[model samples]
Structure formats: C-alpha cells, structure tokens
Target: MCGIFAYLNYNVQKERRYILEVLFNGLRRLEYRGYDSSGICIDSDLSQPSIALDPAENGLADGSCKPLVFRQEGKILSLVRSVYDEADSTNLNLEASFSVHAGIAHTRWATHGVPSPRNSHPQSSGVGNEFLVVHNGIITNYEVLKETLIRHGFNFESDTDTEVIPKLAKFVFDEAKTEKGEQTVTFSQVVLEVMRHLEGAYALIFKSPHYPNELIACKRGSPLLLGVKELSEDANGGTSFHDSKFPTMDGQPKELFFSSDANALIEHTKKVLVIEDDEVVHLKDGSVSILKFDYNKAKNHGGLPRPASVQRALSVLEMEVEQIKKGNYEHFMQKEIHEQPESLTTTMRGRLICGDSSKAKSVLLGGLKDHLKTIRRSRRIVFIGCGTSYNAALAARPFLEELSGVPVTMELASDLLDRQGPIYREDTAVFVSQSGETADTLLALQYALENGALCVGITNTVGSAIARNTHCGVHINAGCEIGVASTKAYTSQIAVMAMMALAIGDDTISSQARREAVIDGLFGLPNKVREVLKLDDEMKDLAKLLMDEQSLLMFGRGYNYATALEGALKVKEVALMHSEGILAGEMKHGPLALVDETLPIIVIATHDACFSKQQSVIQQLHARKGRLIVMCSKGEGPLVCSNGSCRVIEVPQVEDCLQPVVNIVPLQLLSYHLTVLRGYNVDQPRNLAKSVTTQ
Candidate 1:
C-alpha cells in the first residue's frame, strides 16, 4: 500500500542535486501504487552542520548534523517543491558532493493516522533525530511498543506506526551500548533487536548519523529488493553480476538501490536480489551482507543468537522500462485496456497447440505438468484470491468444473481466514493474484500450508512471494500492469485457467470435441478481443450518456456473471460511482425494487448458454420502464431487446466460456471514460492502493 526507494553510492562522488533527483524519480515511478503523501531523507554535510539542533537534546556536544528530511501531505511533486523552497530560502548549497552517502524515500498510503506532514514517513526518534526510518506495511504491535517507549521518555512527533520504529532503535542502541560498550554493538545487531519486538508486515530502511556511510534494510510479509550496479574491472561491463554468487564484482558493490518494486529500480539496474522474509540486508563501505533473523531464538529470548549470514542470487529483470510508459494512450488504464489483444496472445504463447492436418489439439502448462495427476485426483479444487483476481476465477469456475470433473469452489481470502475454512489434504488450492504479494492471500497460503493442502499459485509477477512459496504455479505473462485498476491481467488470468482446465480434462474421451472447440476458441480468442476493443468510441459515447448518473446496475448469469461483477467494481472504484452487480435469477427477489426509469442498468445478454434466460431478464426489466443498456452479440440485439427504446451495445461473440474475456473489454473502456468525464484520477482513484498489502 506504500512505496519505498533508497539509494546508496560508494567510492563515487555525486552532487546533492543529482542524489535528490534520483530519489524523487524513483518515487515518481511508483506513484501508480497510490499514496496520499511523499517524503525523503538524505545526509547533510556533516562538516558544516547546516541544520540547527536543540541544545538540550543534541547528543553531540558540538551540535552535530541531522539528516535533511522533506515531507509533504500530497503528491511527490509537492515534496520536491518543498525541498527546493527550503534550499532557496536558506541559501543552502545544492552542489555539495559526497563520495559515500545513503538516502531513503517513501510514498505513504495512510493506515495509522490522517494524511498530513506530521503523519508522513521519514519518521525520526526525537528532537535529536538520532534514527530516521522509511517504512512500508502495517506494524501490528506498534501501540504496545509506543506506550513502552513513551514510558522511557521518548517523545514522538509523528502519529504513524513508523515513528515507533526509529524510537525503538534508539532505545535498543542505548541499552546495548551501556551494557557492551559502544564499539561492541553493530547497526545490524540493533536492527535485529528492534525486529524481535515487531509483529506484522513491514519493509524498513534505516539510516543514522551514528552509523554513517552505512544502510540497513529488513522485510517480513512485505516486498523488497536490492538493485546492484557494479563499476569494478572484473564486472565484464555490468553483465557479469548475473553469474556471480553475490551482487558484487570483487567482494564489493559500487552502488546499491533498494525499492519495494522492481519498477522503481528498472531504470537504474536490471540485476536485483529479492529480499526474502526475515532477511536483514546491510550495506557497508562498498559491499553488501545478508543476515537471516532467527525467529526461533527470538521467541525464547535465549540471549538472542547472532543473525546467520545468507547468500542470495541476483536475477535479471525481464521487463523493459518502455512497457510501463503510456506511449500514445492518455492514461495507463486506457493503454492497458487496448493492450488486451497482445496480452492474451502472450498468455497463451507456447501453451495452446491448435490441431492441424498432422496432429491433434493440445494444451501444455509445464509448471503444472508434473502435478497434473495429483490435481486430477484431488477431492476438490478451491480458487482463492481477492478483487479482480477473484472475479477471474469466478469467470473460469463453471468450465473448470465441467471439464475437470472436480467440485470447484470460490473463497475470498479474507473471509476464508475469518472462518478458518476447512482445507483438506486431498484438496488442490489455487491462489491467484496479479502482484502475487497480496497480504491476505499470503496469510491464507500459510494457513493452507499448515493444513497440508496442495497449494498452487497463478500470478503475473515472476519473483513474488506466492511464486517463491507455492509448490507449483503459472505465470500469466501479462507484462507490467501500471494502472491501479487491472485490465489485461483479468483476461490473461481467465485464459490461463481455461488452459489449465483443458490440460486436466485431456484424458476423457467424451469431451474430446468440446476440448478441441475450446482450443480453437483459444487460438481465435485474441482476435475476438481485438474486435471487441473497436467498441471503445461506442463505450465512450455511452459513458457520456450516463456520466451524470449517481448509480449504475448490471445483471448477468452463468459465465458472464463475473463480467457483471468486475464491470461494477471498475465503475465503483475508479469512476467514483455507486454500482452493484446482481444475478439475473435473483432480480425478482430483491434487486427488482431498485429498478426504475431514472436509474441506468446494464444487462449482459450476450450469446451464451444463458442467452435465453438473459433475454427473459431484459424483457422483465423493460416491462418496468427501466433505463436499459443491453450488451449483446452483433446480430442478437433485436432478439435480446425487442423494443427500440433500450440502448444496445454490440460485442463480438466468442465461445461461452471465453466470452467474459471479451465482455469485460467494453466495460473497462466505459469505466475509463466515465472516470475522466467525472474529473477523477483514472489510474489512481481516491483511497485505493493498487496492491492491498494491509488488512
């Protein structure tokens, strides 16, 4: 829900202006993740000590320097302006150079307090600002720790859970220095001590004057990665680090970058090491060291053993920076919505083999091939995810159950955790997420692991937590979705799951023709999506007709039910309109009461097995003088909507199971236009974060 970016350079002189620019640009790349405030912390020139300090709190007798911190309650640009304004007002030198220095920046999505400068990150220990920390994710036990620190005479300036972290570090450092002497305690040791008391997800970067020329970062239940740029002669022009045991040229790294997402570091370096849970990364001099926190020892408090050293391999990132940019499109959502044709093709690139005169049709998923037998024999299959991922599963559920001959069920990750739902050893659980680092889904994965379920992950990210921890899984290959509202990933997910179902059902003879038909549909699916996207102008015009409305309603049944729900979600979240998706069968029960001429309603009566039922629904809604916008097949608009008064949206028809992938395209475009027409942020809506890292 928040973004973190830090930069460290050693043995290379860089001006303060260049350093601040790098930090600010990194945060700008992560602006898509959604945040209310932004801040940054950089080292001050210690020789001059430009910042004034309170005499009573100055630990250094000569009034030592404190880190330069700039925080603002709005966009990253505002924070940048604030920094320049301070520099201009004080006549501070922006040309000061440093050979070895570290800086950290953050974009915060509020959880513990209101959005204000006082509540922004780069939170410090006290008036002396002994320790500065930029943190992402929730600190579940912060209240208890805050109270204890307050009793110890530690005053807090910010009302953030992050404030407790720096104070706790100061407390631990003081206690350790008094007992073992100042030279005996290390920065990593103090950080490990502070981590022992923390209980929830967090990715933290700490910098202090006491530990100059060094930086320490640790993460648990949150995402973090280190990017390496080596300048040593042994580094074969920056390509040799990929094959090295560590992210170094000759036992040292020339530069280091830490970020919560690879997007922030892609422009700096492609070689990165994803930090695993409980691993503490320390950067000193010109080298890096990874230390593993021993949770078992911490629980017993048996004098807390020194953290064990670990090795992490550096992997090259596959994505290019151009993929994240909105080249010709006005907004990322619009670009992604139009990119569906190619994205769907990429999702099925090597997987679907269409039958020719020489061979028969087949579906190959190498990640699941070894475990297909166990999945086929499982007692049940459960699809677990949240939001768009969950809706994609719903879109694929009926077909999977029909082909696999297994009972398929759906569960929202949070609700499943609340109920402690039954997960059997014989069950196959599939976890789906675009980012793959979803907090509740990860917790549910741990729960399923404890219950012995055969867990599988389906995500777009390659090195995310779910991909690393699952027994086996699939990568959707829907490249670099930058918008807060997901578009291409939704279709790609359904396409992948459809292939999965075909693979599991390959042994049955009765469904051979059915499977071949689906295979043909798969081959033709991308083209169908291409055709559906032609309705963009139409959807935009429709949006203009309904943009002023206060609420919207959508109804569907069978396969397209997921389409209705997803469409409604897009409108509600990005368009800032109240909308609801209803089952056509349940319309008579309660939803019919809300139907009238003034309210706009969308009914998906597309060509499918449920076409007749949906046609009947259109008639029923028409009898009530409802303002109907019917989404139907190209030639079936007259059949679905016999009357001339109702608005009609004609979409290309595909296979029933594959229609949701095409059906959701127009709605995505409609939502994008409606959001722009309403003057709201289309890519990053208010009060929403792209990745739900907090409960």
Candidate 2:
C-alpha cells in the first residue's frame, strides 16, 4: 500500500517552503499506510533567472520551466532531509527555491520496481518533462505497453511499470494532435486516449505544463479522495488565502487537497468526494469536474470520456481527526489494544439489544438482515481473508456453523486462488478484511463472483473494494487502526460475525437458548474486554520474564484455537520472535517434543467443551518441566494452575463460542509489551503494512 497527497492553490502562487512543509506534513500523517520510498514534484516558476535548477540533484532538466522532482530511496523523512540539505548548500530559501501553484507528493510501497531513487515516483514523460505523474495500483499490461512504446522510439529510466504512463500519454497526445492536424490538442482529450489504452487498476494524479493550472486524477479499483476547502470563508468571512495557521506570500482563499486516505486531509476539510472507478476528475479554475472513462466508444466518438452532468455530493467524514493520532499511549498498537472495549461497543451499537425476557435477545445487522435467510439456506458458507483477517474468519467459523446449521469452510485467500477452488451458486462466500482492499481477498471475491456464489463482505473500512463489489456486507466500525499489526479490527470483525451468526439462527426454537446465551455474552463483551485490559501490567511483567526466550508456543482447543493462532501472530508480527500456535490435540503428534523448561508455552484452557482436554495437555507440559503460562476461566484458575505450579492469566467466563473475543485480549497485551520491552517499533513493524494492496 502507498499514500498519495497533492495540493493545488487556485489564483495565487504559494511559497515553495510552505508548499513543501504542508506536503511533508500530509505524507508523515499517512505513514501508517507503509512505504519504502517517497518523492515530490513542485511546479516551479522558471521565468525567474535567479532560480538555478540543478539537473543532477533534481531530475533531468527540461528546456521549458517545469516541475522539479526530488526523490529518495528510503523513508519520507530521508527525502525531506535531502531537500533541506540541498537548499542549505544552494543558499536558497525553502519557501523561495521552487515556488509553485500546485504540487504532488507520494509515499510508495514498491510493486513494479526496486526501492531506489531511479524507480521512485513523480515519473515524467516527454523531452521537456511535459507530464509529471504519481500513481498507485498495478498496470497488468505494462510489459507489452512498454515494449510497444520502446518500438515507437521512447527511452525509459526506471524499471517501474508506472514509467510507461507518461510515455504513453505523450504518444497519445502527439498522435491525437497529428490526426486533428493542429499544433496542440486539449489535455483532457489526451487523458481520454491514454485511459482508453490502459488496462488494470490504478489511481493516478499528474501535472502537465500544457495545463499548468489544473491537476488530473483518475482511478479504477484503487481508493482516492478529493478534499475541497473554501478559502474565502473564515471566522470574519474574509476573502484572503493567508490564514493565521498557514502563512502565505500571496493570500489566496482557495486550496484543493487530494489523498488516498481521508485522514491526511481531515485537518484542512471534512467535506470530501470519494472518486469512483473509471472516473476522471479535473481540479482547476476553482472547481472540480467528474468524467466517466469509456474507451472504445469514446475513441469512435470525439476522444472524450462522458462528463457527469451532476457532481457527486461531498460526504462529511464521521471520524474525528484526533482518532488517527496515538494519544495517551506510546504506540498505535497499544492504543488499539486498549481501544477494543469501545471499538467492540461501536461495532455492536444498535445491533445487539437486551430487552425484556418476552422480547428475547436478538441482533439487527442492517447489511445482512435481508440476506441471513438466504445464507442459512445455502449449501455452505466459505469465509475468506488474509493474515489477521483470516484468523478472524476462523474465529467466527465455529459460531456460524453451530448456529446456522450451515457447513463453514475457512480458506486463505491466496491459497484458495492457487487451487482454483470450486464455488457454486448455492454457496455463500464471505470475505473478511480490516482494509476492504486486501489484494488477495479482493481477487478471491472476484473468483467467487464469477462462480455465481453470493458474496458478502465484512470489513472495517467503509467504501472499500470488497464492500462495494460484494452483494451485501457489514462494516465493523472499529474506527481507524493505524498499527501494522491489527488489534481492534480482529475483535471487531469477530463481534460482527458473531452477530451475523446470532441473527441467522435466532428464529429456530431448538437453537433459541444457545442464541440467547451468545447474545447475552456479546452484550457483556465490552465490559469483559475492559476487565481483560486490566491485565496490561501483568502481561508486561510476563513479557519481561519471557523477553530473553528464543522461541514461544501457544496451545488451544475448540473456539480458542483461533485465539491461540491470532495471539501467536500478534507476538511474532510486532515482537519479531519465533512463535507458533499448535492445536493441543496435535501436540501428541509432534509439538510435544519442543516443550521444555527453557521454552515458554502459553496454553488456553478456558471453560469450553475441550477444557478438560486442554487441562490434560497442560499437565503433560508441566510434567516435562515446560515453562507453562495458563489462560483459564476466573475461578478455575486454581484448578488449571494447581498449587501455583505454573503462571496463570485469568479472564471472565463467556459463552463457549464467544470466548475467543475475550481470550484474545491478554495475548494482544502480551505481544504489545513484548515488543516494547525489546525496543522495537510497535506501530509499524518491520516489513509489514496496515493494508496489503499488492498481491
């Protein structure tokens, strides 16, 4: 995943320093998206003879005045340092070095090219760098397109598939001009020609000297949002762009902000228009226009995509700006772990209700209400996801199968695609992801859709790809999870899925007691989660004890198996340790060999059908002098621990199927503490991302 940010000030030129500062601030806020390299393009005023454009340090110099691109092969901070260093050596003001009207910046998660300055973004096209482009998502046909462009005498500098966009745009622009027998063609027409030839998903933003006042953004299958601010309106209703917060050389009241995430622009404006697929937006002349891109028909007509007669209304973001920040906690992961109590409450709000006994407890999930009956009647239900989301699906699988009497199967999205699995119209396929844009999950959803299975999406992100493409879905309103290792979203996903299972089987008389029990457990979950969070200090103490251990093992049976897997994952993901989750039943088969006094083995023997079996497993481990850490029901701690022979972590008892929601909390805390003890970056773990947008 990558983050794209752009700014356009209408009617006034901004100081280069102010522009860079704002752009850099936006990129820093979006660092949660994860990136390996970053770059920025500033439209410089070349008419000023005092401005010296260094060709080597910047990009290849164009004969005409054009945007200057500065890129680095590492973090966004490194790029900022490079820019500031260059400014110091040249004796130029950061604000005056490259004054411009518009600029674009990008934090890249490399997919098409190696993580290097040469392969970084702000890719340009044509001899004078006519178009400066930044893009997200993949161009599946880039290889063939690149070959064709090379045959047409185009040279390339980087190995990125994105480099082909500018070259192809230049080719199309020249071809259209030649056919029209004109000295110049409109930039919008050239964009249409380029869109017609491009294939696969992309969210692209570009600037061209031909249309210096405007910035063009187009997207299909990738997220992009346009934020608009009214510069003329302030507290006193003045018409000046220079606000007290942001000082500007030329006062202009109008600014347009664009980003892949809404969080980046929340400080500037809450009103945003989410760009839909195959839509091109032109932000210029203090206005925005939306155009629908259709290739073949548009080519035969006037080489223009159909312009939308009416613009889509702006949607105000419900989340507050402060929610994105990690406050009171050292890391976003810790904050999220502590936020599960409220997140689960929000996820169940208005859905799980406790009324009179005559009313009977029930769930009302709006997105899945009408589809529950169909799902209950389906031949089978397939739960699909990747990583933490996958563990969440596994956590919900048992509850779904037990309540609805529907066989449920769990599949890793990638593996499902690799096997070319069978899906039928009678099946109900459910896709779960924290960021609805998980690449493999989205691909799996497409495959299931093609097989005619009814698709359902359960994701934390609203308006994500899976949510839009699925027939029906639930948004697990866990708020924004900035941590790379998911904490709140997993519990929230399980909560939503548990509610789904409750809704599907509530009407059956035989299952009424079971369903009521689960509904009651769900009602108590938020408080139970709050109670579990109290173990934070204890978990930290335990983590300190285990920090020196080289390997760790977690054992569980029944519903808590998912908990064990997820807990182990959290530790391994953020703590950077070798951890494995093994079924207690499978321990005799092989895993028992690893158990010893030197290793830490966490066991989940919480009250369930398999509680007795797990207790036996713990006894066996203890006999072998294995370092035992037992998680069990509140009062049963003594029964499982036996005369304080082993360490114990206690959790309040809940319904059998719903135990996973509470059981996972302490493990999450342990992982967080372990990472902190080891002095690792808890929020952004190495080589992991909040969202996996690339397959």
Cα lDDT tens digits, model 2, 66-100, are 66788898888899999889778866455564222
Global Cα lDDT for candidate 2:
0.83
Estimate, for each residue in 443-514, the C-alpha lDDT of model 1 and write its tens digit: 999999999999999999888999999999999999988899999999999999999999999999999889
TM-score of each: 0.96, 0.92
Enumerate residue pairs that collide in model 2. Answer: 17-95, 231-253, 241-252, 241-253
RMSD of each: 2.6, 4.4
Q: Assess the local accuracy of residue 188 in candidate 2 as a C-alpha lDDT between 0 and 100.
A: 67
